[model samples]
Target: MSSHDVHDEHLPAHRSETTPATEPIADPGLPAHQWRPTDVDPAAEKRAERQVATMFGLSAVCTVLFVVSYFVFEIGEVTTTIAGLGASTVALGTTLAGALLFIGIGIIQWARKLMSDHEIVEMRHPAASSDADRAETVAAFNTGLEESGIGRRPLVRNSLLGAIGVLALPVPVVLLRDLGPLPGDTLKSTIWEPDMRVVRDVTGTPIRPADLEVGDLVNAEPAALFETDEEGEPLVEGVELQVEKAKGAVILVRIEPDDITPGPGRDDWGVDGILCYSKICTHVGCPISLYERTTHHVLCPCHQSTFDLADAAKVVFGPAARPLPQLPLAVDSEGYLVAQRDFDEPVGPSFWERDSR
Candidate 1:
């Protein structure tokens, strides 16, 4: 419809009569309604009603086939192929798609061939509803329900209900399959242990106090990441290495010894001017490395959560509610930086157990 072709009922009586001819907005009345073939003939009406019922019945059949296909063809069984796609995928997808598509078609047919087709203009009114307004709304809803004819057409209504009921059966089955083994105390600790050498991330070389100048920040991880067995294969490989490194990552920063403000029982957590804290942000566990050396503050680029590196890595600014967990640091006899012990408090984002600490 043209922008100016709004119905004449929408035009205001106060509209100017003296407006220029070209400037006057066109006011087209409601378009003429054409009756469908089913509306004009008794036989055509019955045929259309039957067609809608047939589509709904087919939808029910497809839903039944979906369950049968689930057990007949296993998930990983690729021996049987249809057009290079797995037989299981083809059967499950086609049946499920048809189940949804047929129901949509049946609803469209019902609305187009039988429902009310009158058009009426409703005037604007106050937004709030009173007792009288609520009564009228309920009356209108009952009138619409009568017009839908679901009460008289058992074939169409019952088939649609049956198809929808069968479609919901797969949900609980899939959810039960996805709930694997439970996790027990896995998230409470990391690979860090007593005397674990703190090494640079990319290069496996250990860090020393002199290696980091004052106002310097270095990204480091536990030496377990680069450890290998006698066969020259990783001691921790695959998903295990990925999970450990993510939790064990830390940032080493150097500040004046007097600038360090220790939390309770944390005075010995640092060595000389060097302090080590978990790189993971407390807000949502993003890797924090963006450091302002002058302020001894590191910012997480993911959400701009800044942490104070010198003052026990307390939350200086942003959305983080807790301070970064400090890793107790000690020097080994060989003059390499090492973890005195695993962090007293769990690292990463807060969990159920962290609240008690």
Candidate 2:
């Protein structure tokens, strides 16, 4: 076919001359009003009002019961059980749910039975409001208030108010516990101490400078994690061990001797080009070991915070505000790597009490 004929073939066909024009959909007008039992009968209306009030009353009672259960049921150790769940957990969950559920049900009941039942169509208009529309909105709000009968139904209103006020009590009641034992100097210190062996993580084997070659990185922790007291009990165990392990995590890296540029007084920090730094990222405390052997840069996988290990673990290219806290390394009498001293500064993310700078 000719190009013109091909173009014409692809063009949309014109409407048929016999085709009828499309008609607009007819509006389905509102159905005839049906009066509810509460609307027509004074007795039913009074009963519904009492029911809504009762729901709100129950909400307030549940709120009080929630507070009581918090104290009555010991949180730790399941001394009691309800359907295989801890008694304290079940009591707290049920009471809190009851407090919220009853308040919601009371409001739904109040709207369905007591609030104005008249139905009216709202015509769609421009979304941008004019001055007149704003005034109309305020007027509509007042009309809705009047129709809701909040002022007339003092029982429902007062009960709902009381329930809401009681609900707020749980906020402080739960939050006050979290004020907690102050962190003290915990964040500022770790299990690391002078002469503490830098042991390989998981295996607890002490590391030596000879064990790593140039560009090698080994995740390490303080030896206290594996040591024992005079009585043969673990020096650090349970939750205490876990907390100290996290804070005391370190990474030992071996770089070329000439590649390292130590900061002031950090000359002796590394032993034979082997240096130790916190495994925790200075940005948000995510453990980082993504190392670039060529550039001597370690990247935090969490936020892409890069630190140059050769440059005293300085922040190189990401959101980390400070250098990774370095641990001074030394050789013990056994020739195993050990910490000369704890880090001079804190490790991990900044907290409210610490000077972030």
Whose lDDT is greatest here?
Answer: 2
Assess each prediction's global lDDT (C-alpha) against the native: 0.85, 0.89
TM-scores for every candidate against the unseen true structure? 0.62, 0.72
- Put down candidate 2 lDDT per residue, 2-51, tens digits, no spaces: 99998877766663235677999998888989998989999999999999
Best by TM-score: 2
lDDT of 1 by residue, 21-72 (tens): 5776688878997778876888987887899988988888888887788678
Per-residue lDDT value at 313 in model 2: 91
lDDT (C-alpha) at residue 163 in model 1: 74
Candidate 1, poorest ten consecutive residues by summed lDDT: 175-184
Give the clash count for each candidate. 0, 0
Where in model 2 is the C-alpha error above 4 Å? 1-54, 67-72, 75-84, 119-146, 151-155, 165-169, 172-186, 228-238
Instruction: Identify the runs in model 1 with alpha carbons over 4 angstroms from their true place.
Output: 1-99, 105-146, 150-186, 351-353
